[model samples]
Each structure stands twice: as structure tokens, then as C-alpha cells.
Target: MSQIPKIPRRIVTGIKNGRSVITDDAIATNVSEHFPGLIISDIWATSQMPADLSTEIIVENTAFPVVPANGSYFRYVSIPPDKDLGIKPLEAGQVHPLMHKTATLDYIIILSGEIYMILDEEETLLKAGDIVIQRGTNHAWSNRSDTHCIQLAVLLAAN
Candidate 1:
């Protein structure tokens, strides 16, 4: 199993006193431990309805309790090689243990290493610089390499 790398802390810059300033800097929130060798960093998120803003905001919200409608979420995910997810396939229809439907369009980009995009009876190998547009489909990610894989995903809530 590959070890988790020392990921850099996140930094948010905002206007303070009519000038740009460092507002917040820390790791991501809403991280899930459901999968082994998997690390998800919730970067940013927004509400379904737009909030009335009287002033400029740096980081409006970072919580991801649930995916909002008409909003979006930016996330960072890392998967280690030869991960033992212990996920079993679903019996009803074609589904994976990590497979779940979403009401959003996901833009997935591979940053480093290699991974497989698992679907129902199908798999696609993705490498660095590869991109996948997941249209709210049932899918999962698997790292079969001997190294760690990093990916960035942007999920946009769809109607």
C-alpha cells in the first residue's frame, strides 16, 4: 500500500481592508473514510440559492454535508496503488461497490500516476493529464499501479 503524501495546505485569499489578504489556510473538510487508500479534500462549495451579498466574501462555504442543487463543489482526491477497497459488486443491474448515481456533472482530471475508471463491466485506464466527463453516472476509481495517484474533480449540480 502506498503511503499518503504530505499534501500542501490549502490557502484562501480575499479582500481585507480594501486589499488582498490570506483569509484561510488549512486542509480540506468533509473527508470520507469509506474507501481505503482514498483521500478526498473538499475544497469549496456553494448553496443552491444565491445569498444576498452586501460585501465581498473570501470563502463563502466549505461544508459538503450534501450536494446542493444549482451549485457546485471542487474536490481533490488521492488514490494509492493496490488498494484493498473490499468493495463488492452490486447484484441488481451493473454496479460497483463504489458506484453511486449523482445528480451532477463531474469533471475529473488526473494529475499524477495512473488509475482505472471502473464502470459496469467496463474499465478505462487513465493517466496524467487525462480528463473524464462523468455525466452523473455510476462509476468508481481504482489504482492498479505501484504508485500513488492524484486527481482533481469539479462537480456541478444539474437539474
Candidate 2:
């Protein structure tokens, strides 16, 4: 078996031609383990889900009610249709705004495909399994890949 590689987290984009890119994807890494391509839906359970327990998600307008499933862990799913696909030709470091449930901490995770997360002037790349804790911050998920970017969010309720 090939060893898993490590990539430093930062703002990087447009390295599609680089072989090192496939290694950067935390999702693609798992996909390469046994299955080929991005058909690894089997790894998106509550236990395997990325993000913190205090999270909530609303995708394409589909609202996933908050669930407290563990001592300090939880996640939510906002299916497509509610998420407004942003403008085309998404730049390398542009922050797209996403609406979140009023009064909550949202932890975003990608279920499938690649999603570029923009928070302010910082943009981070997330693949399946990669998690980001959005603590009352403005953000958006952009699908630069040629596939649908399914995502799961864990939102911490704001008191």
C-alpha cells in the first residue's frame, strides 16, 4: 500500500496540471485506497463525517434539522437546490458568501466532489472528509470541479 501524503493547509488554486494535486485531496486519497474516482459515498457517515459536533447545514435550501448525536459531536446536510451556485470562472482566491442559519456555528464538510470554500479574502479547498469550522463567518461553497459538490455541515447552535 502507498503511504498517505501530508499537505500544508493554505490558500492555493489552479494547480490542476500538477500530479501533486491528487495527493493534496484528502477525499481523493481515500478514494484511491480501494475505489476508483470519486465514488466514495461509503465514508460519509456520522462517525466518518468531518467538522465539529456543533454544526448545522442548509444546502440548496434543504434544511437539516440540528441533531445532537454524541457527547460533543454532530453534523447536518443541506442538499442541493437551496445552495445558490455562484458566478462562473471562480477566481483562485475570491470569497463567495453563503447563507447560514441565523445564530449558529456551522462546520462545513464535503460529501463528494471538490468545493472551494471562501471566507472573507481566504479560500480553502475541501474534498470529501475535509472539514472546516465556520464560526459565525460569512462563506460560500463553489464547485470548480466538473462534478456536483455534495456537502455536509455540522452547525453549533447559538444561544
Candidate 3:
């Protein structure tokens, strides 16, 4: 299997003594492997709407909730090729093992490589620079290419 690339650096800015300053600038560390070769890096989060900027942003290293109640989540995901993970192509009238739903509105941007967005009854190929506004739905991502597919996603809690 090919190696997954490192997560990108995160730069955060905030007010310091009434002047804007770079508060955090470093490679993101809240990374986890959900599957054999699938990686997710939780970059940041907010616990409420009209987020309080006065408070320090503390990114927790614990397992993140799928959809934070009345909050938002920002993360990057790296999906390895399905073949490398021993996942075979779906047969007709089949459902992927990873097909699931979340109570969040997801904004996804493909950062590199390509992947297939598998819907309940259809699928579409997404490549670098492609964007997806995924409402709460049952879906899955399948990477059939030879390399990893990296994507940046922001999930907002939905009613």
C-alpha cells in the first residue's frame, strides 16, 4: 500500500493585547486512524453558534463526537485505496460496509487524489478540487485509485 501523506499545518490567529497575532501554528496533532488505512485529523471545533472568540481554542485529543450538539467540527480525512484495504468492488444491489449517516451538514473538499461518493442507489466520482455539500444522508466513500485521497471537511450540527 502507498503511504498516506502527512496532515497539513494549521495556523490559528487571535487577539493578543489588542493586536491580532498568530496563536497556533504547527502541524495538526489530533489525528486518528479509524480504519486500517483511513486517517482523520480533527483540526478544531466550536461548541456553539456565534462562537466565543474571547476564550482560548483548546483542541481536545479525545475521540470526537460524530456530530457535536449545536456545534461544528473541522477535520481532514485520508482514505487509502479500497483494494489496499482488502475492500472489493460493490456488486449490483449491494451496500458498502461503511455506508452510514450523520446528523450534520458536511462541506467537503477533495484535496488530492480521487474517490467515489457512494449513495444509497448511486455513486459519483470526485477528484481534487471537487466540493460536496453533503446533507444528513446515508453515504460512503470508496477510493479505487492507487493512491490515497485526502479531503478537508467541516461538519455543522443540523436539526
Against the hidden reference, what TM-scores do the models get? Answer: 0.76, 0.43, 0.92
lDDT of each: 0.69, 0.42, 0.85
List the candidate 3 regions with Cα displacement exceeding 4 Å: 56-65
- Clashing pairs counted in every model: 0, 15, 0
All candidates: CA RMSD in angstroms? 4.4, 15.0, 1.9
The candidate that achieves the highest TM-score relative to the unseen native structure: 3
- What does the lDDT read for residue 100 in candidate 2? 36
Order by TM-score, highest first: 3, 1, 2
Comparing 1 and 2 by TM-score, which wins? Answer: 1
Candidate 2 lDDT tens digits, 1-159: 111222112222233555334222343222211121212222122322344433222222213233334212233232222132334554565434342333456666776656777666676778888887776566665556555556655554544
For candidate 1, which ten residues in a row score worst on lDDT?
A: 56-65
Q: Candidate order by lDDT, highest to lowest? A: 3, 1, 2
Candidate 2 regions off by >4 Å?
Answer: 1-86, 90-102
**Comparison by lDDT, 2 against 3, better one:** 3
